[model samples]
Target: MKQVLSLWIGWRFYMARQSNRFISFISFASTAGIALGVAVLIIALSAMNGFERELEQRLLGVVPHGELTGVNEPIHQWQNIAQDASLIDGIVAAAPFVRISGLIQKPGGFQGLSVVGIQPDLEAKVSSIAQFMPKQSWQALAQGDKNNIVLGKGLADSLGLAIGDTLSLYTPSMGATKAQRIGAAKSHRFIVAGIFEIGGEMDLGTAYVPMDYAADILGLGDGVSGVRIKVDDVFAAPRLIRDLGYSQQQYMYLSDWTRTQGHLYQDIQLVRAVMYLVLALVIAVACFNIVSTLVMAVRDKQSEIAILLTMGMAKATVMGIFVVQGALNGILGCLIGGALGVLVALNLSSIASSIEQMLSVQLLSADVYFIDFLPSQLVLQDVALVISLALCMSLLSTIYPAWKASRVHPAMALAGR
Candidate 1:
C-alpha cells in the first residue's frame, strides 16, 4: 500500500503543473536532449554497420582473397601451382590470371585501365564477377576466337563505348631500344564484348579479356602473370598466400585484397569508434540535465516533503516518489527516441538516396568509393543497448535528488514555509 501510494503521488506530481515555470521547462529540455542524443547515435552506428556489409559483399566478393604473382618471370606452371595450392586445407579454389596495364582508346582520347585476363569457368571458382553480368557476357572471354574485351560500366560510360564497339588498347612498348619504346607504346584492338557494373571506383580502372589474348598481346606465350585464390577466411589470406608462395619454385609476390581494400574497412571502424565515444559523452551530458531537473524539483517540493514526513510517511517512501517522478521523464524520452531511431535506421539508405536525388548530389562518389550512396543497417541489439544505457543513466541521476528529498527536516521545512 505504501509503495502504491508513493507511485500515485509521484505520478501526480509529474503530471501536475509546476508553480515555477522554469522547472517545468528545464525538465522538458532534459527529455529533448536525451532524445536527440540517442537518435543521432543510433543513426551513426547504423551507417557504419551498412558500410561494413557493403565491404564484405560488393568489394570483397569480386576481389580474390589472396594472390601469388611471379616476380622476375611470368608464371609458366600456373596450372600445377593452382592444383597444389587447392589441395591445401583452408584453400577454397585457385585460378590463373594475366594482368595488363594499358589504355583504351576512345573518341575522347586514351583512358587508362588495369586489364585482367580470365578464363570464365576457372575464374568463377575464385571470384564473383560472373554474378554481376550476363551469362553470355561472361562466356565471351572463353570463346578465345577473337580479341574480345569486357569493360567495367564506369569505363564504358567515360569512353562512350558499348558492347560490339571496337576500342583500341595501348600498352607499354616491349621494343628492344629505349628510343623505340619512348616513341610509341604497343597498340592493339578489341571489340567490347561485355560491360560489368559493380558500382565501385574499380569500375573505372578494371577491365577483362581472354587469358590467351592477354599473354599473346604481351608476346608471352604459355605464361600467366599470377594466381588468384579464394580462401576460407579473408583475414587469414595473407598468411595462406605466403605459405603457398613458399612451395613455389620461382620468386613470387604474394598479396591479398586487404592490401588494396583494407583502408575502406579500417576507415569505417575508425569513424564508428569516434562517433561512439562522442555520442556516449553527449548522452552523459544530457543525463546531467536530468540531475539538474531533479535537484530543482527537490528544492521546490521541500515543504510538501516535510508535510508528508510529518503525516507518518516514511523517508524511504518520500524518496521513492521523487525517483518515480524523475524516471518518467527518462522513460518517455527513451521510448520516443528508440521508436524514431528504428524507423529512420530501417529506411536510411532509401531516405538518403531520395535526398540525394532531390538535391542533385551524391553522398558517396562512385569514382572514389567502393559503394556509392549512404547506407544504413539497424540491429535490434544496438537499439536495445542504447535504450538500456540511457535508462540506467537516468535512473542513477534520480538517486541524489531523491536522497535529498528524503533528508528534508519537517521542522526546518515548515519553519521556512
Candidate 2:
C-alpha cells in the first residue's frame, strides 16, 4: 500500500512540476538533449555498419583473398600449383596470373600501373570482377589476342581510350653486365577490347590481357608470376595462405587482402569506437541535467514534502517519489528519439541521394572511397543498447536529488515555507 501511494504521488509531482516555469524549461531542455544525442549516435553507427558491408562486397569481392607470387622468377608449374591450392580445406579457387609493371602512353605523358594477364575461365572462379563485367568484355581475353587488352573505365577515360583503340605498354629494364645505366625499353602495342568499371581506384591503375601474351613478352617461357587464391573466409586468408604455401615446396612470396587493404578496415573500426565513446558522454551529460531539474523541484516543493512527512510518510517513500518523477523525463526522451532514429536509419541512403541531388554535391566519391553513396543498416541490437544505456543514466541521475528530498526535516522545511 505504501509503495502504491509513493508511485501515485510521484506521478502527480511529475505532472505538477510544470507550474514552475524555469524548472519546466530545464526539464524540457534535458529531454531534448538526450533525444538529439541518441538520434545522431544511431545514425553514425548505422553509417559505419553500411561502410563495413561495402568493404566486404565491393572491395574484397574483386581483390583476391590471398596470393602466392614466385620469388625472382615465374612459376613454371603454375597449373599444378593452382590445382594443389584449390584442394586445401579453406581454399576455394586459384588462378594463374602474369604481372607486368608497365606504362601506358597518354596525352604527351605516361601513366604507370600494373598490367596483369589472366585467363578468363580460371579468373571467374577466383575473382568476382568478372561477375560485374560484361560477357564480351571479360571473354575477349580468352580469344588469345596478344594485341588485345581490357582496363577499367577510369583508366580508359583518363587516357582517352575506348574499344578498338590501340595503346602502347612499355617496361624499362637494365642492360647486360649488371649496369644500372639506362637500357633498352621493351614496348608492346595492344588494342583495347573492353572497358570495365568497378567504382574504385583499381579502375584507374590496373589493366588485364591474355596470360600467354604476358608470358611471351616477358620471356617467362610458359611460366606465371603468381597464382591468385580465393578462400571461403576472408579473415582466415592470412593463415590459410601460409598453409597453402607449406603444401607447395616452392619458396614463394605469400600475400593477403589484410596486407593490401587492411588499413581501410582498421580506419572504419577506429571511427566506430570513437563514435560510441563520444556519444555515450553526450548522453551522460544530458542525463546529468536531470539532477539539476530534480534539485529545483525538491526546493520548490519543500512545504509539500513537510506535509507528507507529518502525515507519517516513510523517508524511503519520499525518495521513490522524486526518482519516479525524474525518470519519467528519461523515458519520454528515449521513446521519441528511438522512434525517430529508426525512421531515419531506414531511409538514410535515399535521403542522402536526395540531398546530393538537391545540393549538387557529392558526399562520397568513388575515386577516394570504395563506395560513392551513404548506406545504412538498422540493427535492433544497437537500438536496444543505446536506449538501455540512456535509461540507466537517467535513473542514476535521480538518486542524489531524491536522497536530498528524503532528508528534509519536516519542521525545518515547514518553517522555511
Candidate 3:
C-alpha cells in the first residue's frame, strides 16, 4: 500500500510540474492526436449510419414489404389469399394487384411505364402511396366513372401531362388472328387523376389505375399478377416470405422488399466497412505519436527513475505509474472528442448547409442525391469502441517505455545527469 501511494504521488508530481516545456508540448500533442482520431471516426461512422437509414426509409416508402405471386397457376381466389395472409402474425395489409408493362403517350412524347392496378380503398392500408399524392386523390382513381389514372411525378413531367390531361396507354395483347404475334396491341385512354412524388425511381416510372381497367388492358381474365403484403416489421419479411412459400408449395412465388433491394443494401455495407478501415488508419498513426511521446518521457526521466528504483519502488509499480499517466491522457482525449462528435452529429445538417452556402456549391442536392441534407446517427457502441481502443493504445504505448525506465541503472543515470 505504501509503495502504491508513493508511486501515485510521484506520478502526480511529474504531471503537475510546470518546469518542462518540451514535455508539456509533447503531452499536448499526444492528447490532441487521440482526440482528432476519435472525432473523425465518430463523424465518418455517423454519416454512414445516417445514409443507411435514409436508404431504408426511401426504399420501404415506395416498395411493398412482401409480394406473393402465382408460380404455375393463376391466383384466381385472391379474396381467400388476402384473408389468409392477413391472419399471418406480422401482416398489416394484403392487397391484390395486377402489374402491366406499357408506354404512356402524350401529344408529342412517350415514355415507358409500369402500370399497377389496385383496389384503392385496400391499397391505402397497404402502402404509403396514399400519403404521398401531390394532387388529386387515391380514392378518386378507383371511381369507375372517372377513368382516372395516377401518374408518378417524373412520368407526368416526362410525358408533359398534368392533372385532368388525357394520356393514352399502349399494352401488348394477343389478337383474335390465328397467326398473330404472341400478344396483340391494346390501347386505352385515361384521365390523369393524380400525381405522386415518393422521391425515388417509383416516382419516375410507376402509374396506378383501377384494377378492372388494368385487368382488361392486360388481357388478364379475372387474374391478378400478385398480392402485395404490408408487414408491421420489415426485418421479419424474409422469414415470413420463406414460411409463406413453404405453406403454398408449387402455387406461389414469394418475395420480400429486402430481396428487391438487397444488392444496393449490400453495397452500402461494403462501402461502410472500407470507409472504417481507411479511417482507422488515422487512429493507428495517432497511436504511433503516443508511443513516441511516452518513449521520450522515459528517456528524459531516466535519472529520476534510477533514484526511485534505488529508494524502493518495484519495477512493476514503476511500469504502472507510466501506464496510468498514459491512460489519463487517453481518457481526457476520448471524453472531449466524444462530446464534440455528438454535438457535431446532432447539428450536421445545419453545419453542412452552412458550408455549402459558404462554398457556393450544394453538397447534397436533391436533384443529384436521394436526400437533401447531411445525415448523422451517433451510435453508442461506436462511441464505446473508440474510447476502449484509445485507452488500449495508450496502455500499449507505455509497455516498451516503462520497460526501458525499469532497466535504468543508478550509476549510469546519475553519471549522465
Candidate 4:
C-alpha cells in the first residue's frame, strides 16, 4: 500500500501543474535529448554495418580468400597442388591463375594494371566474376582465344575503350646484360572481349585474359603464377592455409585477403567503435538533464516532502518516488527513440537516394569509393544495446537527486515553506 501511494505521488509530481512549468519543461527537454542521441547512434552504427556487409559481399567476393604462391618461380605443379588443397578440411574450391603487373596502352592513354589469367571453366568454382560480368562476355572469354582480354569497367572508361578495341600490353622481362634488360621489354596486342564493373577499385586496376595467352606472354610454359583457394569461412583463410603446411615447404608461400584489404576492414571497425563511445557520451550528457530536472522537483516539493515525512513515510519511500518520476522520462525517451531509429534504418538507402537527388550531388562516387550509395543495415543487438545503455545512464542520473529528496528534514523543509 505504501509502494502504491509512492508511485501515485510520483506520477502526480511528474504531471504537476503549470506553476511547476520550469521543472516539467526540463524533464521534457531531457527526454528529447536522449531520444535524439539514441536515434543518431542507431543510424550511424547501422550505416557502418551496411558498409561492412557490402565490403565482404562485393569486393571480397571477387578477391580470392587465400593464395598459394611459389617463391622462386611459377607453380608448374598447380593442378596437383590444387587437388591436394581441395582435400583439406576448410578449403572449398581451388583455381589456377597467372597474374602479371604491367602497363596497358590505348589510343589516347595508358594505365598500369594487374592482368590475371584464368581458365574460364575453373574460374566459376573460385570466384563470382560471372555474376557481375555480361553472360556473353564470359562466353567470349571461354573461347580459348589467346588474343582477347577483358578489362575492368573503370580501366575501360579511363581509356575510352569498348569491346573489340585492341590494346597493347608491355611487360618487362629479365635479360643478362643492362642493354638487354632495356631492350627485352615484351609487347603483346589483345582485343578487348569484355568489360566488367565490380563496383569498386578492382574495376579500375585489374584485367583478365585466357590462361594459355598469359602463359605464352610470360613464357611460363604451362606453369601458373599461383593457385587461388576459397575456404568455407572467409576470415579463417590464413589459419587454415597455415595448417595445411604449404607455407613451410620450399619455394612456396601463403597470402590471404587480410594482407591486401584487411586494413580497410580494420578502419571500419575502428570508426564504428569510436562512434559508439562518442554517442554514448552524448547519451550521458542528455541524461544529465534528468539530474537537473529531479533537483528542481525536489526543491519545489520540499513542503510536501516535509508533510509526508511528518506523516511517517519512510526515507526509502521518498527516494523511490523521485526515482520513479525520473525513470519515467528515460523510459518514454527510449521507446520513442528506438522506434524512430529502426524506421530510419530500414529506409536509409531510399532516404539517401532522395537526398542526393534533391541536392544534385553524388554523396558516394563509384570512382572514388568502394560503393556508390549510402547503405544501412539495422542490427537488433545494436539497437538493444543503445536502449539499455541509455536507460542505465538515465537511471543513474536520478540517484543523487533521489538521495537528496530522501534526506529532506521535516523541520528544515517546513521551516522554508
Compose the digit string of candidate 3's lDDT tens values, residues 1-417.
Answer: 855764585468457634667767777777887788788778878888887787767667558888998876557778777777766888788888988787766557666788888887888777777877853568776774456789878677767788889988776654446445325657778888888876546667688888877777666778888888888888898987676656653478889988877766787789778877876676666666666766777777787778888888788777776766666677777888788877787778789989998999877655555555677888989888877877787777767876777777878898995
Off by over 4 Å in 2: 1-7, 173-183
Off by over 4 Å in 4: 106-109, 173-184, 245-250, 365-368
Tens-digit lDDT track of model 1 for 270-388: 99999988987887788788889888988888889989999999989998998898888888888888888888998999999899999999888987788777878898888898889
Count the clashes in each prediction: 0, 0, 3, 0
Please write out the lDDT profile of model 4 over residues 278-331, one tens digit for every residue. 989998998999999999999999999999999999998999899889998999
Estimate the lDDT of model 1.
Answer: 0.87
Would you list the clashing residue pairs of candidate 3?
Answer: 173-183, 173-184, 174-184
Displacement of residue 63 (Cα, Å) in model 3 is 1.1
Off by over 4 Å in 1: 1-3, 17-19, 106-109, 175-180
TM-score on alpha carbons, each prediction: 0.94, 0.90, 0.81, 0.91
**Candidates 1 and 2 compared by lDDT, better number:** 2
Give the CA lDDT, 0 to 100, for residue 87 in model 4: 74
Q: lDDT by residue for model 2 over 16-123, one digit each (tens)?
A: 978999999999988998898788788888889888887888789888899999997779998888778867888999999999997777888878889889998889
Candidate 2, clashing residue pairs?
Answer: none
- Arrange candidates, best lDDT first: 2, 1, 4, 3
The best-first sequence of candidates by TM-score reads: 1, 4, 2, 3
For candidate 2, the lDDT comes to 0.87
What are the lDDT figures for the candidates, one per model?
A: 0.87, 0.87, 0.75, 0.86
What is the Å distance of residue 170 in model 1 from its true position? 0.6
| lDDT at residue 293 of model 1 (Cα atoms) | 88
